[model samples]
Target: MTASYDAISPARQAISSARRVVVKIGSSALTSLERGIHSASLDSLADAVEARMRAGSDVVVVSSGAIGAGLAPLGLTRRPKDLATKQAAASVGQLALAHAWGTSFARYGRTVGQVLLSADDFARREHHRNAQRTLERLRSLGAVAVVNENDTVATEEIRFGDNDRLAALVAHLVGADALLLLSDVDGLYDGDPRKGDANLIPEVRSRADLEGVIAGTGGVLGTGGMASKLSAARLAADAGVPVLLAAASAADEALGSGRVGTAFAARPVRLSARKFWVRHAADARGSLRLDAGAVRAVARRSSLLAAGITSIHGRFYGGDVVSLVGPDDDVVARGVVEYDSTELTGMLGRSTHELPDDLRRPVVHADDLVVV
Candidate 1:
């Protein structure tokens, strides 16, 4: 079904039955200028989470607001524009943010564990696997995992763009059944909410639901806007995780399944964690340029043969992530290369029959590839 906004979608039903969930709170929802962090919001959130946990659902919180919380302590009136300043703010704010969350949850007898992550942590397979173990262990120990991006150490190029995307990836990492994105806005509006004449959309079954729907910019203190939240929702849905986009004030109702926000249905099938990592997290070490026939072949889910490659760029080892570029220089796909750049250099444009037995294998197997 299309995103009619009122349908009883499978994803909405999935939200009510989700045994494990990831709730992402935006910076605007958690902090303000008068108070670095909102204590009442934290208390309300803890209550909702506690209720969910009591109902057999374990919760992971991916939150933003470190920079916002730090603004008060650093005497900054607004978010800093410089990288060093933002990092400095994050270092200070993260500690304060964690402390507030711990204290807030502690009142309800809940133990909160802070997990700070960088893009590198999710990009590297070993680190990603380790992170999974850590979060699982935390849940097993009966602690709530509160995660945030490692903003202090992140540079412009390495940043996750916004916590919205980070939260979506975290949902995939923890095998979450549902993802709830909390923002200042109540739900996605058909028109600009600020300008009126808008209607709240209640459901999205696919990316087509977002067509002609323009999203607004973020708040003064937050980095992610409605656009980013929509992107996060789409990402999580693509990974077979349903999503709920709602306002932070309606946390209790949203958690209680009051049908007050937009629900995005998950796909029938999704990429495995390892494949998700390769597609969304891995940093490509090199690119393999393919000819027209090879592009068409790869599009048909065929394994990439060495005869398809015209040339290579950059240094990469076996099992490393590589981009499959078309003749037009567009990246057609990404995959785990079977051979090193050096090993593949000599086999370019040569058929499997013409190559040595050791090099006769497909350059990249279909299982390791994902079409973009």
Candidate 2:
């Protein structure tokens, strides 16, 4: 007879057995226009997280609601369009948001630590490590790290835009085994959930599973929609972390039972730490268009040489991350540029033997390059 243990899929088992998890709650799930931050929803979330903690699992929460919570209190009926007004609202709402989270978690004898982050935190290696250390320290002290975008100071270009992607990045940074995205929608669907014919998708094994699905944006009070959630799911999945997407109302069931949402199975292959940082963490400062030969060489894991560079786009200096673009304009890889754009302009299409001793090095060293 065949040995029998549990019939649960590995993805489902991952959810139930996750030791450290990242739970991301969206604006719509945590707040309302009329009442501002919803205490009941937060309380329920705290209950679930505390239960996990009691079971010796560590939990991190990436929450969105600062602007939404600030809207009603600041006399704004709708989300502000102007950057200044949005920032002002976030400044006011973040305090209330943090207070609500702290109070809710306190009910279960748990403490919460608020962490505000910007895109720069993840884009820069030193900053990323610092943020990771802070979060790890907080968890070591048995406190839930409640994270949000530093919206009051973040510019449009540097903003995370939504917490979904931030949560996925955090999952990777902290080495989380699972990520739970709690939103207003229960799960991904074959079509728009607003339509009656749509059916909830219980599992997503790969990107191919979402071929015909239509994901819509969030409501008036939120920034992300189902599309962002799916993107976040795929991001975490690529990092070998399983993800569960479910409605906030089903927090307990989704986290504990692992039976109420769409579970995305993680990719089997694991990326190197350096490659993961290069692919997911570093921000590209510029792009280098490569010749056909250069593209072929890069595909074979070779260093990028000035002789293969056809053109460069944008201005960047040495030590900055840059995209390696193919002749067809697709980004084939990314790496830390070894030469400034202006310096590279003088050296392009010239072989290393023809260059001065100091300029003979690869444009991007093989150790720094990561295939996309």
RMSD of each: 2.2, 3.4
List model 2 lDDT by residue over 7-29, tens digit each. Answer: 56789799879999999998988
Q: lDDT for each of the candidates? A: 0.89, 0.89
Residue range 227-247, candidate 1, lDDT tens digits: 899988988998999999998
What's the TM-score of every candidate structure?
A: 0.96, 0.94
* Model 2 residue 114 distance off true place after TM-score fit, in angstroms: 0.4
**Please, what's the RMSD in Å of model 1?**
2.2
Candidate 1 displacement at residue 282 in angstroms: 0.9
Give Cα distance to truth, residue 42, candidate 1, Å. 1.5
